[model samples]
Target: MSNGVDRTILTKEHASGTVDRDTDLETVLRNAGRLSPRDALRYLTPLISVLEGLHTSGQSHGSLSLDLLRVTKGDDGAPRLRLLKGRPRKPTLQDASPKAALAGRMLLYSSPEQIQGAEACEFDDMYALGHMAYTLLVGEPYWIEEVDRLGFMALCNSIIGGAPEPPSVRAMRRKSIRLPHDFDAWFVLITTRKHPDHFRDITDAGIALTSVLSNPDIRELSRSVQFKFNPNILESPSSAVPAAPENLRFTAVFTIVASISLAIAIVMLLRWTNAQESPKRDPSLQSTDGAPATSNPSSR
Candidate 1:
């Protein structure tokens, strides 16, 4: 347990040991790596076992704090994480139960202090797993941090207690720091509550993320097009890439023909209007010397 003075809360009937309190953050990170996808899942295998035990016993580790945890090397030199102290209180809340609220915060915010109440609901666990997967892929926190600071705070408020914001699409851009394709599955999985039928489960989310990230055909096509066109410097991509059909050569040709046809049609219409408005000379109008006669036909 941490050498710190934090009080321990009872997770089991008789709590055997305290929270891990080793001060080596690198060792703690190493232990975390054991559970993550980027590293061997063995080091972190015990965490799953702990979570499982919590699930079976209908109890949860309240007020989990990663900072307080300590890491010690086993005889085999593999990292082992021990709990140091219980969290002071629950981290965040949702409209759901304390457990559900905690789970939502853990998934949305990655805060250990708030996970005390996270129960093992299907959606909650799935979201948390996705959150873990995203952190693994991007080597950072959740995608929500990609937004501006205020927007990020507002998003945190919405996810935990405040009004929800629209799903962010800006994270998908190429210049974005953490690539959207990295968290494709997590995005789909988390949004599944909002769109159930599309992403059925975690497996589907993983597959979709993989496909978007690894599509060779799409990559090849993008490369081919990038080399083919020197887009107009003044135009944005939305304007440079016209909404014509699939075959770019045919589409460009057809667009040119259509534009020329429209221009000719407009010119012809303008000419017709100008001709109709011109004042015509009246043949019957009487005049002095140069003008002919005017009203003799009716008299004859």
Candidate 2:
């Protein structure tokens, strides 16, 4: 923090992840197999959105090191990541490089341009973002054989001159955790092979390459088993409900039943009324043996 109001770049109240990096990354590394490309996109696209905004505005964050980015629980208890602007790194003399006194973020996340002391441009930030992204998804940075051994000049040379393995391959090489099926190939295809013809336009023209994952080729690889989200983790939508309250609905049913009962009762009442209103049966006119009422008159 600059301790001055004018220089504050980050929003307030975020927790650092240094202590929690291993623990937080543990889940991602272990569940890499079950992780879906969509979820990955969700977790990462926001950071890209921020970077895109900065790059579009002709600004660049020189230090996008893993150590500076923090992950904390948000208001809703969902994990949120925030990046703090870090100072540019300068190589220490160490009786070797041009400038060694100044220090910044870790070199693991630094771009070749940054390593060589080139102007801190937006692409350099992108390179760092990509490295961080690879680490987040696969649990490690891309492999460079002499990463630790080759100090300063040699390290910078290798980083610039040699290509690193695809993130999936490096993750697989670690063999510490189970990986998603076909994830290695799918990762390579999307990140490296996809939309080959137009890749340069986004980079060379200084256009903000918002998201590489938006490529259709990358989406195609998602249909493969490895990138699929587990069905078990998918929360079922709440069951559809009637617009009316249950009590009201039940009352409606009860009213209908009562109406039917009342109708039946009314029909019975009508029948009884008709019977009472009708003339009395001619009991005196007809005999039990079908004889005329002449015998009944004498009896009367």
Every candidate's lDDT: 0.40, 0.48
Model 1 off-target regions past 4 Å?
1-40, 59-79, 83-122, 133-138, 142-150, 153-269, 281-300
Please provide TM-scores, in order, for all candidate models, with all chains considered together: 0.38, 0.47
Residue 190 accuracy (lDDT) in model 1: 48
Instruction: Tell me how far the alpha carbon of residue 2 in candidate 2 is from the true structure, in angstroms, after superposition.
Output: 33
Candidate 1 yields a Cα-based lDDT of 0.40
* Model 2 C-alpha lDDT versus the unseen true structure: 0.48
Model 2, residue 37: distance off in Å is 4.6
User: How far out, in Å, is residue 35 in model 2?
Assistant: 7.2
Candidate 2: segments with Cα more than 4 A from true spot: 1-39, 90-105, 143-145, 176-300
Q: In terms of lDDT, which candidate is strongest?
A: 2
